[model samples]
Target: MKKQLGDSNILRNWIKGFEYCEIGFNKPPNSLVYLACTSTGRVSNLRIQNLDFYAPFPNAICSLTELNSLEIYNWTGLHGQIPSCISKLVNLRSLVITKTSISGSLPSFSKNTNLIGITLSNNHLSGTIPPSLSTLPNLHLLDLSSNYLCGEIPKGGNMGQFNAANFANNTCLCGNPLPTCFNSAHTSAPAPAPVSTTMFDSAPVPAPVSITIFESTPAPEMAPDSNSEFLSPRDLDTEILLLQMKKQLGDPGFLGNWVIDAICGFTELEYLEIYHLPGLHGLIPSCISKLVNLQILLITNTSLSGSVPGFSNNTNLNVIFLRNNHLNGTIPPSLSTLPPNLSSLDLSSNYLCGEIPQGGNMWKFNAANFANNACLCGNPLPPCFNLAPAPSP
Candidate 1:
């Protein structure tokens, strides 16, 4: 890193440094940031990345009051408490430090509202999340995954917007987006397996063979935050639409009022193919429409009974094969709005009809792609009535 810093210049009683910011211990494997300059009060953007710094972060950082972004990442052998003095940097907008060995209770961010993102994942940090972090008006993303955090997650404002995947692989986090923390969750609810949308319905109904009916319970008491939404649905009723476990998904706004839930947390999911599960039925959850990142979706040889799921948001779709299912509906022209990345499409052996939208990416499929849809039409298949309309001029 000395090579990256080049020759240094001295100014007055302190040395104003430039670009001592990025240091890595991986090459020769021994350099660490041990800044000891007299405070010149000039730091605006400090990024310390990929190093073997195992010491408490330099206290001199507090003197850099002008700092707006402090990024510390991938520190190996790092073991120390994040100084409480961090609250002194009232100008900080982004604080990201992941993959470190830093351990301790999380600090409060109530002193400032400038923060936009906070990433403290893959560490040994323990204790409940500071509920005050939720009240930051500009806060957008908070990743506390893969830590030893215990207790319930804060569910208010935008806190409920993150995917449950962001909170996965942790120790004993409950309520809202995660499983309920109450004993009522365990004793009163015996949910069955295959997850469907009815799970979020509020009407008094018997639990389906695939879902356990969770008796309602008030959410755990939360740390007070005036900016937070009033806890109305209770922690257990965040009204989550949790599918099966083992699949990470949570978007409480998309789920239930009793608690937080999501249909599928596979935000960037590219490939999905499930088949031959007779226990699966009903129209594919309308929520599949939210998987905007979906690329390959196949529901073949199953008991899936629905109109083909709409992929209007999933423009990256490259292949879609849904054969030998119990689906019936007109092929949505909206599928034509999908990205032209489509390399193949097979909607055969289902009960479908109507002229295929030959606009945009739809005509790329051939006869085999729409095979056995005795009631369908357009190119690749016989036209609905007369010949398929000529390609647009």
Candidate 2:
């Protein structure tokens, strides 16, 4: 590192013939004096990892224009906005910063074309994830866990391969594959109130959640309308749900159990998620199975305690997440018969017991998903296994 007290610009970018440089040491007064002897704007392919450069002058690091790949790691004391100049690193491909205390909204990176991977875990940053970041087609290993990020997860990206743990601990994040926020309008209605089993069993009948959809004739293809905004019918359904939630929350005496109604109201919904309401209890309304359109259902960390409802008959059902609840009873045999399209089925952290369901459509997931449940048993778990009987006794 060099510093110039007088003039140092005439010789910048003339690094003789150095291709890469790494500066991870302190810059004393003498070092600063020498850095001045050298010029700027020529350093490229630099890797200044694990340095106190940010401490002496955080703004100093942003001036480097030749960085093609930057890794600022183990520098926990760095703070403030990543200078907007970061976008100037047009050739930057990999940006990795771990074990830092940096805070602020990540700058918009829509202009970045070559960036392929970003790892910003274990930080103190907060804000909604920019949907633009989701547009990076080459991003493969994004680790933004353990941050203060809140809001609905941006969907419609090709993010199907990432496991749920990649997003674990971000309690506020909602939507597939993340669980829906318990207080979001979709799940804001209080959970079903507890009731005596006899009362439920003696009822004349359970009202099934149902919706009738009339197939309409297809519209003729036309040139794409430039100004037309296409609103999905499902989006309209969610808007109506939010409106109902707002009205209910406004009236103090309004029924607190609105989420149950929300679930019951959207029988035609193809996707459903409810997450993180500690006070929510009682059985999942049996009426949910009546939703023939249901494809993805996630209900996590509620006060719900009951048998996993039978979906044996719902061939359209695919992914189901029911972790961290009071749910107990044997693994449903009907789940084994899920349609071939089914991929993931997580029921971890509950009171569930009995042999793990070993079927064609389900059980493809790893064993960690079924952990913390005391009663579950299968090839992956011992003791719950039936002991081999003595010869033919």
Using TM-score as the measure, the top candidate is: 1
Q: Write the per-residue lDDT of candidate 1 for residues 130-240, one digit (tens) a residue.
A: 778778765544677877777777767557545576677666678777887775221211111110000000111121111111112222454556754664654323223
lDDT of 2 by residue, 50-93 (tens): 33434411454456544434445445555554555667755554
TM-score of each: 0.41, 0.40
Deviation in angstroms for 369 in model 1?
Answer: 35
Evaluated against the true structure, the overall lDDT of model 1 is 0.56
8: Cα error in model 2, Å = 56
Model 2 clash tally?
Answer: 11
